[model samples]
Target: MDFFNILILAIVQGAAELLPVSSSAHVIVAEKLMGLDPTSPEMTMLLVMLHTGTMFAVIVYFWQAWRDTYFSSGHAFRSNARLIVVATAATGVVGLLLLKLIKHLVAGNDPGFEIEHLFANAKLMAAALAAAGVLIIASSRLPERANGALNLRTAAWVGAVQGLCLPFRGFSRSGATISTALALGSSRRRAEEFSFALAVVLTPAVIVKEAFRLYQSHALTVAKNGTSLLQLVGPSLVGMLLSFVAGLLALRWLSRWLEQGRWHFFGAYCLVAAVVVLLVG
Candidate 1:
């Protein structure tokens, strides 16, 4: 990819990663529109970097809240910490199982671009986006409640929804988890905060997974493609920096908009985006 293409993709990844919109969907669409191959190892590496960048953004934005909620000595803080742990564990279990299922169905027999049913599959993405939109819109309609005071059952449901998002690129993890939490009677701010905290907790595993994949790809490449793996490092770092800056802004905007109950606007936007993608694809 050229500099301009990489710049655009980085911006898209950074901005979309924090929104209730799926960064994966936005990045894939950007790759298609830019005539870039989504299946390239370079592209995959860049994506990992972008994800890491947004992960950092989440950490920076929520540092204070996490300290207050998880590190405080108060009884309420301890209880909230336990609840977050339970929810995070649930999310991990659900996400792993769903990812395994997708792997078996798509990447099991034939692990190639054809097997990449999760990428650039407009129909699937559109449907996933619509589902997420509905959930978020519905959550926005519910009565507001206190932040960070979730019960176990509600936390489990949110975690389960997060797991479902693992296999679908258009299904935003943050959107699903936050919406599920809200639907389960958690307040909007609390849902969003917890969702981000979970992200901070889980991001390292994802980064490690991608790093292992990148290593395997390097060691097992065929003697046909005359590309150097090292070339991706610069682009990946650049993309990561860009994504961090953009993601911070997006997170702030999303938090403000969600608190004001303006999330239906995103739902409408997703509906329109789905229609456009369906027609284009």
Candidate 2:
């Protein structure tokens, strides 16, 4: 891909990744419009790097809040640590199971099947976007509940919902997880904090998985072309940097809207975007 194309994808991924609107959906559509193959190994590698950039943005933006909340005391630290572990465990189990089911149902006996093949499906992306939008709107409309401590049950619920987002491109992870937290009576502040915390935990695993998949699928091609893996991923470094900046800006916007009780507006935007994706994609 050219530098211009990489920059565009980076911007799209960076902004949309932090927002309730799905980044993968937007990135895939952008790739399609630019005549790039979303399922290609290089594109997958680029996507992983873009995610790494946003993951760092989450850390940078949330570091102080996390320190004050999760690390203020020994007991607080332990309790939050346990919650994170449980939630991450739940996410892994549910996400893996769903992935298995999807592969079984979609690929059947095909030996070379991979879920990335579905990343560019406009109909599926639209449906997933609509689902995420409804969930966000419903949660936002619920009556305000008292702010409560993060509990294991709520964490598990949030994680499970997050798992549901794994296989579906337009199903926003932050949107579903944060909405689940809110609908389960968590404060908006806590919901945002916890959702991003889970993101920080989950992203590394996803990057590793994508990297492995890229190697498995494209190692031969790279060898034949006499290209090193580093060479293939070199252009993505620029995209990562661009995405990091965009992600920081996006996080600020998301936080402001969430705090100002405009959370449902994101859902409305998602609904509209879904229609646009369907029409143009």
Q: Return the top candidate by TM-score.
A: 2
lDDT of 1 at 138: 81
Instruction: For candidate 1, write residues 1-281 as lDDT tens digits.
Output: 77787789888988888898887888877787788877667887888898899999999998887787666768867777677788778877987777677777767745553324566678999898888888878877888876536888887887788878877878888888888888788888778888888787777887887777777775555345656777878889998998899999999999899988898777776777777668767
In model 1, the Cα lDDT at residue 47 comes to: 81
Deviating ranges (above 4 Å) for candidate 1: 74-78, 100-115, 146-148, 220-222
The regions of model 2 sitting more than 4 angstroms off are 109-111
Best by lDDT: 2
TM-score of each: 0.90, 0.95
Sequence-dependent TM-score of model 1: 0.90
> Lowest-lDDT window of 10 residues in candidate 2?
142-151
